[model samples]
Target: MTTKSLSIPLDFPFPSPKAHPLLTLHSKIQFPCKFPLFSLPQRIQFLRNQCPPKCQNPNDNNNPVPYTSQQEAHFTETQEAISQFLQEFGISAAESNSIALNSPKYAKMLFDSVKDLEEWTSWKSGGDGNEFATLGFKEKVAYMAKEKGDNGKVAFLESLGLSLSSSMNVARYLHGESLPNLIHKVKYMKEILFSDSDDKRLVGKYARCMMMNLSIPIDEDLQQTLSLFEKVEARRGGLDMLGSSEVTFRCLVESFPRILLLPLDLHLKPMVEFLDSVGVPKEHMREIFLLFPPVIICDITGINRKVQALKKVWAFDKDFGKMLLKYPWILSTAIQKNYKEIVSFFHMEKVDKSSVDTAIRSWPHILGCSTSKLEVMVEQLAKLGIRNKKLGQVISKSPQLLLRKPQEFLQVVLFLEDLGFDRETVGQVASRCPEIFAASIEKTLKKKIEFLDRIGVSKDHLPRVIKKYPELLVSDVNRTILPRMKYLKDVGLSKKDIAFMVRRFSPLLGYSIEEVLRPKYEFLVNTMKKPVEDVVGYPRYFSYSLEKKIMPRFWVLKGRNIECSLKDMLAKNDEEFAADFMGF
Candidate 1:
């Protein structure tokens, strides 16, 4: 579609009516005219003297004043000015007062006749048919007829075929009517002045006049008033007017708070169109727009209908629609504030894991702000035995939840770890749960073995140590065996042998062998190397036989000079050799 640009001047002035002749005369005449019964010629002369230079038509003086055209033009201008003034205040004339008055036919005729006479005099006098019309003789007649009673007022209004409410006078007296009422009054006056006149030009004049007169007390009312202009444009089929209305709406909505709450639909198509034309922020409008629900469902059964309607209206923006699905609170301020209650009211189905995950993923920061809530949620997952890493990732990513109460978080993490969690998982959980590392585990079998290695216990000996010291498994090997191992080399066994024996026998003996061996190394060494002959108590027999066998070798060796051979080894093997070797 081709777009038409409307350039509404920022300072368009309302058209003002020409001054009334009677008012001019009254201003000039200091004292009331006592000569009320003047001749027709005298009255003419009197009017001519008071009239402005433009109204002195010498050629037309003899004829009755052709005041119709002049009065119509003057009234039109004055009405235009009034409408413009009202529009400036953000008031609309149309929606405010659309009803015509109720009265008898004769009364309507009399009223119309009186109105025609007023118009004629206004033109002849070259005066503006405006608030100053009260000075005209025709106006006096209309006022007299109006005061005749309710019947008279109804008749006058009916002649104009306009709706007139009795409450209007009361409303004026009260001064309590809202902006909408003032707009209606201006609109009614404009309609009367420009009824069915094919001059499309006057519409702008009237629109501008209405725009000028408009005023709203609150931002919200101002928005509604501006929106009404858009409606006027749509009805009048004027794109320029619509564009102007849209520009005004944009300015008002931007400046005012809660103005976007005005309903915009088929009834307000022009407003919606204007908003679109001006590129108003859609997201910002979502909450305000939804505030006016076309149909409210009071029961669950009506949900389908509500959803369908909402979908149709919001279908263009999926994100907005989705927001509504999850957060209907966006529809109203009251609802948004009490959103939790609303959620509970609907007995909303439990959010699925995927939904919860999406929410957490979407706003990870919220988890920290709502740690207790999140923890409860996570606990539910735990109860479900969902050991998925994604849960851990969620917790880890939301560091706030972990850091909120470090001690509590750590405790939870440790508890999870104790349930057989792997280190990587535990560490990640711990990062999110800071309380676990607060205290160190006391030394025990497992801790001791770990401590032994920590103190430089060789890896090869670790298993052996564990095996021999079954009882030491419960002892603090780090404090006991570690201190005693240094004493092994001082006792006769080599450090390497001591280390090997401790590793091998520690577990079997169920106590740290290093602890047991440090005090008994000498006795242990003696026991380990004892000969088979000594153990069997046959040392004397073996010694005699060995001497008989080696005596010849010794004699042979002495003569051959092969000294320190078989004879020397046999000499060492004897009891005297053992006694000397031991230094006994």
Candidate 2:
């Protein structure tokens, strides 16, 4: 039967003509001044207690709010008649009584609202009414209870400014936790959130910001979160976190609030214990978590398995911690599976397993990349005729080559190729100075080419100069190269002479003025008694060892009292020099 509105029958015989028994029950069962939120079952218990055993309305005979589940007649209509008939939108019975006594029109409007709730709870909204209608009376009641909860949670998050589209996103990770438990968690988080600061910032909107910018926790308790912070605060490396342990804990909560849900005993302690056992230092723990916050939640047993597998392969049982310190993401990724692929690919290419381990030890993030990604880098290098063991050596020298986009890696190769290097010589340059592959094409490499051109290495000489010393692509122009040039020009070498010397050696600009150029040039002038112009002719003089080759051979020439040019003296093989000078 479908009655269109909320109307008590003309023959509701028990209560006064204007009085609604549902509203009158508000005064009968007195709750405290403070009202608490209730679940569906809890609110229904209030209904069952207040609703009379029988209340009849004999207007003709149709129920004004018909239930799709006819069995609702047994529990809701006949059993607890007035309870299901009143306004139920957070209205305590007390609020209902106030409306009944003072406002007859408002009471009638409240009565009319029950029709919508009745249709909604009885499978008329989205479910199969025919199928729901066949369920047992108690089963139908349970279904309505769950519907209220689902709607309430959505309303709660939406009220916090989470869009309806994304309100469920944070809930997905919570794994079906109840709404009351979520409220309990949010309530405590609010206490900690404003206990120190942001209290004044969000004073007028305290409840609104309690979700911590809508990254709310759904499955944890306040004590659970506090215990996790306590464990982190008490760690030996605890001080390394933003000064004090308490502030560091707050920083983690601020940056990665999901850390609140990770259990200390299961994830935090086990991870720290495993790391300590594996020789990872206590001082590095906080830094590791901050660098890769996901590491705090990674499975300790799985991480230990990866460490054990790596130990078997690298045989660097204690040294493995160094790799972790370099790239903490190794624990967060598929380290074991990726390492196996790296080992197999290197083995197939005839590169040693030790070389693979060395590559990972230097750039452990490569162990996170798939073998297919590594193969793409290899194919790119192979285009420059770098293949087989040469390929492996290039990768070990610069694992970042494996990390670059194929286009980014190719641009660097094309930059070299455009400089007139044949593919094979380009491959040789890559092998010798693998760091060049990592240089930014526009910012680092182009700026370097411009510096070379400015220093009198013309278009014709640029390729020859870079191919001779690929470190030119990687060296800092102002910090390393320009200072060396400035020192050379300051030391009585003209721009022309500096240009000629660098054109000859190509690495002259890359040499350290303090270490190599100054010490060697001082010895050449003061002790060996050579003219400074002598180096322009044989600038490769710097290439020879100062003490072993230059000093020893010059002393020989001085002893024999024979005159020789810089090249004639230092360029000859030891055997040739001895035979000629000693008359052997």
Candidate 3:
């Protein structure tokens, strides 16, 4: 229900009847004595008895003068009620009258005192219904919370000028999660909520729902936020898309709470439709919407261009579908513009098309980097006397080089060069596993090197270990390396067997036990009838794309009565694989 603002007059003997139970301090008059609650007729009789001769009824001398205006009538009736109510509270009629008006100086003070109590009573009783009379203040609050829910309670508390934390405390206390201490705080908040004229929105139930449901507070900031929202909503096709129902409107607010304050036509619509047009599919749209709501409302044309370039220009494999599911924010990056330039720059540097595509598919963001950022480092490598085809090989093998600052790569190269490594040997080490350059000296690389040293990989054999798999320097001792080593031990590989595997194919340590190694090992042993030790003889087989290449080819071969070993089955490219298995 909507409550209108109380427009009580200065001379009115009583506060306005429509006044909220929460209003306090009528400025014009005050009553010294406490006033009792009285019925309407008793109030009228008291008014007639207190009527001055000049203000008395002229035609019917028995009745108080009929008020010429409603304000005067209400004033008369309220004055009478105040007089009788004071008398009922054990205030002598004479003393009440004296306090009511005897001293002209105290008249306003008396009237104010009377008005304050009346306002308090009205709020507590809630007028005609007196719904709050049976409940204490906190109980009343709890009742409101129970009946109206958190949103409603929140609106009520906000109107009171209480902080949200205080309201939450009250809720927690009621739920036995907190102790009570916030009564005075609640009162202070109530005063702030009710007395502030700027917050008229707190008066009506509908307006309260609008603010509460969306967690908006009534304030000057709200006005600005909502003003922008309305402007956006009214844009060319915005209103048509947003529609008119409050339910749908609230749903939008719930889904993207911050969208209300964002620009609509320019920021929200274009990127949303771009994703839709590019086959992002309807089911995954919510994940995109909720995770990156601002995507629909971003300067995302660059990101869109990247997606377009991947499909049209770069001829990126149809793996984009899975990439979106894995990295929804990829479409929000401003990388495509730089990516195109970098790819072309790489082509000029003798990086082959197949190599560039392979590197990009493995690390899609490589194309997003600007070539200029890496030119100094590439030039420095050429200065190291590794140029042309060799330089292309270095970059293709470690496209992550583009991601690092030039100084980072320069330092790593210089650090490797100081370690008595020749230029060619340094390039081979970096190309095999560029992540070593980024691995921490004190934290990651030193710790892993110590572990390998204890495993009997002598300092002489260390270079061979690194040459076999540079990724070992970056692999976690506890999380990746130790766990995989533990799994191999659990599968009956001794320290010697493990060291031999690490020396031959250290890439095996990079595959996760849970995600890659264990599952593939179980599949080969149980389904393909391969022995576990034979599987361990070639741990590199675990690194193959199990779902994409291994399983599909295995199932096809099983159907065709083909008995190829695991290596022959998974080693071929898709075309060679199809030709071998299906005789295409």
Clashes of each: 44, 0, 16
Q: Report the Cα RMSD per candidate.
A: 31.9, 16.5, 19.6
TM-score of each: 0.19, 0.57, 0.40
**Runs with alpha carbons beyond 4 Å of true place in candidate 1:** 1-68, 80-134, 137-175, 178-584
Best by TM-score: 2
Q: Please, what are the lDDT tens digits per residue for candidate 3 over residues 135-225?
A: 4332332232233223222222222222233333334333321111222333332232223234232122222222232321233333433
Model 2, residue 179: C-alpha shift (Å): 18
**Global lDDT scores for all candidate models:** 0.35, 0.58, 0.51
Clashing pairs in 2: none
- Candidate No. with top lDDT: 2
Report the candidate with higher lDDT, 1 versus 2.
Answer: 2
Q: Roughly what TM-score does model 1 have, to 2 decimal places?
A: 0.19
Alpha-carbon RMSD, candidate 1: 31.9
User: How well does model 2 score by local distance difference test?
Assistant: 0.58
Give a tens-digit lDDT track for model 2, residues 209-297. Answer: 22121121222232333344444446554423323323443344433546445554566667777878877777555445544555665
Off by over 4 Å in 2: 1-287, 290-294, 297-302, 317-319
Ranking by lDDT: 2, 3, 1
The residue-by-residue lDDT of candidate 1 on 217-304, one tens digit each, is 2234334434544544554454233223222232222232232222223223343333243343333222223222221212223433
Supply the TM-score for candidate 3: 0.40
